[model samples]
Target chain A: MKLATPRRLILPGLAVAVIAGLLSLLAYPFPDALEDSLESHRPETKAAEEAGPRPSSEGSEGWSAPLPDYSVPGVKSEGLGGALAGILGATGTFLALLLLLHVLKGRGRRGPNG
Target chain B: MHIPDGILAPHVWVPLAATGAGAVAVSARAARKRLAEESVPLVGLMGAFVFALQMVNFPIAAGVSDHVVGAGLLAVTFGPGIAVLCMAAVVTIQALVFGDGGIAALGANVVNMAVLSTLTAWAVHQALRPAFPNLAVAVSTVLGVLVGAGGAAAWVMLSQPYGAKFLGAMMVTHLVSGLVEAAVTLAVVKALRASGLVPGDARVVAR
Candidate 1:
């Protein structure tokens, strides 16, 4: 089989895109895994958390660490999920477009073969 | 740099999406103008080849695995417009089917990896083509890979929260990946050229 045929190429591309999209959707709901993976080596955050609170001097304001707030609006953990969805969606669109364009061009080039 | 959702604020993603859409549109139009029926299959095949190449991940420092982001390679093999189209397709597939990048950040990813890298590589090819006509293929391949990886690193630094370590990590990982991609691209181009699959004229292949 020739590697350059549109019919042969589209199926695999579509299959991959669909599988990736589904996986992303499944991964979206879980946030903790992503955060933990991305932040496993935050030395600064670890150091700050470990050190005791420091008192402020008379002239200088006292050092106070902000409270940990996870309530920021629209913030969600779905890192892997989002990436998967975006890639699949875009890939599907691209493959479909390529197939359509190829068919159209093929038709224009040859009456029956196209 | 497949940035997942929640990494970037919505404001950043939205604008990047718009920019990416515009760039893709322009590239499609350009491709339509230059492409012939015979070239279509080659472009599509190259896209698949890129997808396959991306799957072969090489080990970066520690246990992290990085793969080829073939924006530069595509541009060198095809033209910038076709390369952009091909990469956009690859990235889309990677994001949707593989969960490699976030859906919301698709636009940013395309812009950074596809548009920026292809255009940069093309520009470098144009500049160096005159001086090193014989080495155009190798030079273009190297430039494309380096610029594409560099563009991704830059985008990650700018879009995400500021931190030198983060940027440094991205750059280091991608730089190694880029070199590997460059070597692969050079080998492919050389083989194609030697086999008579690619014509002597660079512009002809690009068209």
Candidate 2:
């Protein structure tokens, strides 16, 4: 089978990386929305409402559930930063992989295949 | 699902990290032996493909979306070692670049999706190879999808001190997603086999 040239492959790979990076940024806001949705409908909160507030118990102080705070202080900047980072990082990795493949191809050509 | 930083408990993250490290080490050694020089570019491209595919999320019930975890498909096409590597790279890129997942939870994500899924698929492929050689790839792909999704749900359930309703919701949502993943994996494997990207002659490639 004819191997795909590094040049031929890198362009498409780079395109994919860029797209993924952008999508990640676009979806960053969605997480907060999701968190809000989850929090509002949280079972614990629902249960607490259904059953009247319990008396403060000594043992329960140490047993609070650890839920993450998904609220972003500055949603706009954080989303942009995340998108830029993702795009740059993915592109860098794709380029690095392409370079490696190019080097390997050269070595293979110089070996027995020559 | 990419569990962001501060979401998963430290105990869960630490143990998963250890497991992921071990799996990655083993996969690296195996990859060195199995992956050809020519395969490197293709593997990288596959990583890109997986990255793209993961972004296309389908809405599940309750307004949540789930994406395909392609580890099993990669394993069947590229062997377990390379598949794991591909998955780890994809996850790493997703976490660091996009902030989709927490850096601290990276180990847990890798272990759940990459290591467990690929290894389980590889095992299923091995066991079913003799009886249903032609169907081995399809069976393994489906099994991998199921195992990865179920295993992930199980991990989340065990890790979180949540009620049964939440656990059930997570598990059911993943189960549906797994079915979609299985179909996609099967189609990809069949297409690759038809196109000769994966050798049609099972005996030659199986070795």
Per-residue CA lDDT of model 2 for B1-207, tens digit only, reads: 665554455567778878888887777656655567755776777776676667656655445667777876777777777778778877766665555556666787788778877888878877877788547766676667666655555554454544565555555666676667777777776765665545644323323
Q: What fraction of the native interface does candidate 2 get right in terms of contacts?
A: 0.12
TM-score of each: 0.67, 0.70
lDDT of 1 by residue, A45-100 (tens): 55433431121121112321121111112436454434443453445445564694
10 residues in a row with least lDDT, candidate 2 chain B:
B198-207
Candidate 1 lDDT, B115-201, residue by residue in tens: 877787778767777787546655655555555555544554454443566546555556666666667777776755664544545
| Model 2 per-residue lDDT at A65 | 21
Stretches of model 2 off by over 4 angstroms after superposition: A1-114, B129-135, B201-207
Question: Residue B181 of model 1: what lDDT?
Answer: 66
**Residue A46 CA error for candidate 2 (Å)?**
11
**lDDT for B56 (candidate 2):** 58
lDDT of each: 0.58, 0.61
